[model samples]
Target: MAEEQMNFQAEVSRLLDIVAHSLYSEKEIFLRELISNAADACDRLRHAALTQGGLLGDDSSFRIRLKADPSARTLTIADNGIGMNREELIDNLGTIARSGTAAFVQQLENKAEGANLIGQFGVGFYSAFMVAEKVEVATRRAGEDRGWLWSSDGRGAFTVAEDADAPARGTRIVLHLRQGEEEYLDAQRIRQIVHTYSDHIAVPVVLESKKEDEPDETLNAASALWTRPKSEITDEQYKEFYHHVGHAFDDPWLRLHFKAEGVMEYTGLLFVPSQKPFDLFHPDRKPGVRLYVKRVFITDDCAELLPPYLRFLRGIVDTEDLPLNVSRELLQNNPRLAKIRQALVKKVLGELKQKAEAAPEEYANFWETFGPVLKEGLYEDGQQRDTLLALARFRSTTREGWVSLADYVKDMKPGQEAIYTITGDDPKALAKSPQLEGFAAKGIEVLLLSDPVDDFWLSMVPAYDGKPFKSVTRGGADLDSIGGGDKKDTAEAEQQDEAAPGIDALIAFVKLTLKDQVKDVRVSKRLTSSPVCLVADEGDLDMHLERMLKAQHQLDRSSQRILEVNPGHAMVKALAAQVGKDGAGGVVEDAAWLLLDQARIIEGEPLPDAVAFSQRLSKLVEKGLLAG
Candidate 1:
């Protein structure tokens, strides 16, 4: 057969134009794409050798080689894998040009987020145009004797010709770096990109030997980091892989790298980033935890590798036992892989618990970054829930920053049957909660859980130990009135409130007046100075959380509140005196609404009806002056 030369299809021309011009903002990413393609080729050959009887035959220092010539302004990336013949090249490249263009266009329209589109779609080969004026791929299939050359200027046309001197079983792509992009022709630049994006690539990546007296200094570790024994690798090496795989440099505050060889055979090198990345919340952030089959790169998008809640983790997992073509969907059930996944979950959580136990301060930092993430597992992961609960940390009524369940338990007051908590959006407000009421008098510490996800995690875990978590604002927490416990001071306060003129009658009046807005109004068993505090009906959502959910558009409206009043307070007495006065409707209603307004404000909630709250407060002051 003879060689063939033709122009690119018109749409291919348009796609090439986009790839070269508007597709990628950082042309350097083209190098990453090319190196990734080379790594993928090597991974295929490695997998085939193991499963498909060595299509590559012998000669197994499997690697990708790079060559650059500054004078010629050319950068070449070569891979010794299952190379393509002319037909394969045309199907892979030309197929995209003619039919794949629309798919890529649709993708561009749907996700116009950032310019990291090479890995997002399967057209990474065309990304060469971002920096190259022309690209040439000379290749030979591993089992074939014939060779081929595929060349294109990326203008919708390409030429396929016979090659007498191509590698016997490899593909070499030479990129003629354009104008300002010619710097890529520097061997040093190529080496940097390979180390960053393709370093952990199961096989070695070799760069051309530039020094006359020495061989090529391999730019990457070239060895799989996961397969190595845990003791032999330093923490620095662990952190480096974390950065490479995660596109981050922050040290990993915690790491779990090991191989499970019993029921399943897989090596995992995972890291917990010391600080959360900016894209931690991005819905499209690529999962960089690569999957490998016997050191052959499979896919980084394998959600089965780790649950979505643990997406913040980064690393590699190389498995020697799985089939190369394992459909990602099948990861859920492959018993061996599932076993491996289970081990990984245990290993990560165990490491976190060990860290928190070993160093409280370091664990505090980890909590600040990932505690909420860990808490998420409490609700979603049932089998792992117990471990995550033990690993949980919190801020309490007593601690400065974070307190573990163990620490809170150590400080539990004698005879305290329930661990108490008060949930409000603001810490300071909750700290002063009149609802925290008698709990403070008993000298019992309460956990101050305030994150938006607090309610969700708390729902999963009802009790830490034998003590059930009791929300202070619940309507009927009968905190056995200071009894013989701390009655000295409470008794004195009770006497003072009782002696205050008209106090008992006023408590009755405030309750009757605010009946419509309150669930059930009663004299406070926990009142100190404040006249009234609102509690939610027994077992209702925290007042602050209900409002927060509504603020985030998660809830429609707030639940009603339980209003508790101080019996011995003078204001309750004064308001009580005028309860039955002739034409006291406007004056008494104004005073009741004003008390409700002030109570909600102190509890860190907004008046639901600000206009009415204002009008009522104005009238209260006017009526007081007329009485004077």
Candidate 2:
């Protein structure tokens, strides 16, 4: 067939430009990425061979070969694994075909910290362009007869043509070194890069010999890092292994390596990354931890091996108990697998607790990245809710940074019965919520929950340490039992309360005026700065939850919310006096609707009737102008 030329996918083209031009600080990273991809291809072949006969044929052994040629100005990385066919080459190399490609591109484009992003999105092939003026990939897929050659110059276009002499059953990538990239041509430099970054890769990485009499040299340990004893492994080895297994560039925040015996025998090498992966929250994202049985590759995407909440964790879990040919269907209901998962969860939570106590600052950073993900356990895994709750950290109205539930309970105001919280889309906005004013004034702290998962878990975890989780925007705040602030502020509040003699009459008239618009209109014990605020009725869903459901189209309509008026506010007092004198006339009626809309706006709820709100607001402003 004639050579076919094609323009790179738009996203891939843009990515190649950024990777080729700007990511020079860590140019050596391209070697690690290419080596990692080579190792993964071998693993895929190993796994595929388990089911298919003769897939490995004569070459049952797997290895990655590196050849650096100074005279030719070329470096080749070859892998004896599952090589790509023509379609696979174009789909995998010529395009960013994954679900989060746009997001991945944006992340790399925006942050220099995205150096680790290369291998993560399966776009690491393009990283070869970082040092190479041109790249050529020659491959023959395992169990296939045809071979293909793909070449690119990192400008805009690439060509794929049939190769008459490609490798029998693997891929070979040749990088034509750029003018000043002679460093990559040095065998010693390639050896050092392999030792630093690809040493933990399970596949043997052999450096091809340049001299006719010299033997090829193995550059890596060629043994699985997880299978080795923790005492024998160095921290650098573990980090490099994480880079290999996790397809990650960032250092691990924490690593857990342990072997369990007795009922079930298994070894787990788990890592929590310092930076969250771009697809951490993608609904279709699979667990990063690969599962192996008795040191043989099984599958990388076994959701049953770990709970979805812990999906951020990356590494491997190898078990001696599971059969080597275990299928995905059996994994779901396997009792032994269930026990292993439970033990794994307990171990991880225990380690996290120790870290939280020993080095709180470091643990706080981990929480900021993975806390929302971990909170999913509260709703899904009731068995480990207690441990997850203990490890959870939250921002609160009275605390800077994150506060634990234990800390929140310890600092509760005198006579405060429940653990107060307010839920919203933003933490800063939740802190300024009018529903929190009275609680804040009384020195009571309210947990400010902003994550969407917060609402789901709060429902499952009704109470903690014997105190119920109470939303400040739900029911009566009951802050009256909690003592007020300093004597001066208390006295001033009392004076304003006494000045508003028409408050009771105003509440009655406003309630009648907005009968259909609100569930109830009552003088609030929770309001101080704002004239009015909205809250969920005692029996209704929390305001935030209801709004969230409506937004998702799960709920057809929202339950009517209660409007709480601050009796001490000057505007409320004036409106109250007018209601008493005018007897719920047009002006007071307009004020009632306008105040309701203002409270809705403050709560971040969309006004039910925006046109009516605008008309009412304009009329109120015009009336004041005319009366003046």
Candidate 3:
């Protein structure tokens, strides 16, 4: 066929521009990307050979070879793997076919370290332009007779043509090195780059010099890093393998390497990254783990390999039992795959539990990085909820660092019946909540849950270790039954009870004045220093949940909250006295609204009427000054 020119997809053009100009911090990463792509091609061929007996044809051995010519200013990467035909070449290279192309480009434009985003979007092939002025690819698909050539300058357009003299099967990429990028033409430099990035690749990477007399050298270990026995793999090897697989620079925080045999045979080399991925919480974030059958790579972005909650986990799961021809659709409903997933989840949670028990400080660090993500399992994976809960950690009012539910229970005061907690968006703000003043006074601990997932998991999991999880901001905390506070508090409570008539009148007056704003008005046992606070009704959504729902545009109207008053506070006492004399006058009415607005402010809620609140405060201050 005659060569045809085509414009790159709009998104692809933008990506090419970024690679050619802006993404220069990691120019060497271009080599890594090409080698990784070559390895993937080899893996695809191996998997295809399982069903199509003739796919391998005469050359069954799969390998990647690199040749450099310093005099010619050229470098070639060749792979004996499944290669693309003419149409496949155009579709794959000329367009951004992925779902999140726009988001990926926006991220690339926004982030300084956006080289990883290219890999995430599967467009690493274009990275060659970082060092090459022009790139050429000649490829022939297995079981096909025709070969094709694709050439591009990493700009607006590319060309595709027929190449009769291409390799029998697989791809060869020739890069015309740009000026000042001649380092890639050295054989030693090529070998070092391959060893650093592609050492864990299962296929052999052979490096050859342009000189005819020099012998070719294998640059990589040419073995699957996970399949090797644990004792044989050194820490540095494991760390390098993690860097290659994860496309990350930091060392792994935790590594789980084990082979599960008997019925379900698989090897898992999972890593918990020391640094969280940039898109860890992105709604469309790609899965990090790859799926392999008998060391033949299948899919790296398969969500079936791990649940969404564990999407941060990066590594490989290679199974010997699964058929090499298994498709992703078939794997989803496959009972064997289900069982494997279940077992893997259990194994990961078990390792985390062991780490928490044996090395809490280390586990705490892991939790600090991934706790919100891990807590998602508590809501999503009901079958493993108990295990996830056991692994959960929280910041508490009683301690300096993180504390687990078990640790909190161990330190619980006598007669404490439930595990108390408070949910908000910030830990520092939660610690200052008026609702917790009473708990602090009684020396009772409260878990400070600030993550958006906190409210969700707590709803799914109401209790841990036989004690029900109680929110300190709820109406049913029942602090009196927990046997807290001192005798002085008891005597004051009795004295307030003797003045019950006056308190009751005050509560009635406040309820009448703020009838629509509050569900009810009552004396608060949960307030020690703060005069007023808001609490969710017995069966209503808590303040945190309300705020979250509103923020998401899911809830339009706020749920009415119960307004509680502390009779011991001077403000409440003065309001009660004024109410007894004048019977719900203007001063008493203003005080009632002021108290509600103040409580809302303390709970991090926006006042219903800020202008009114300011006016009321000004009037009260003026009156106080005149009386003084």
lDDT of every predicted structure (CA atoms): 0.72, 0.88, 0.84
Task: Point out the higher-scoring one by TM-score: 1 or 3.
Answer: 3
Residue pairs that clash (backbone atoms under 3 angstroms), model 2: none
Models 1 onward score TM values of 0.71, 0.96, 0.84
Give the clash count for model 3.
0
Which number leads on TM-score?
Answer: 2
> Candidate 3 on 316-432: residue-level lDDT in tens?
999988888887677787788788888888888888899999999999999999999999999899998888888899998878999888889888878998899999988998898
Question: Residues 388-437, candidate 2, lDDT per residue (tens digit)?
Answer: 99999999887789999999888777888899888889998788888887
Q: Each prediction's Cα RMSD? A: 8.5, 1.9, 4.2
Error of 2 at 132 (Å): 0.9
Residue 336 local lDDT, model 3: 83
Ranking by TM-score: 2, 3, 1
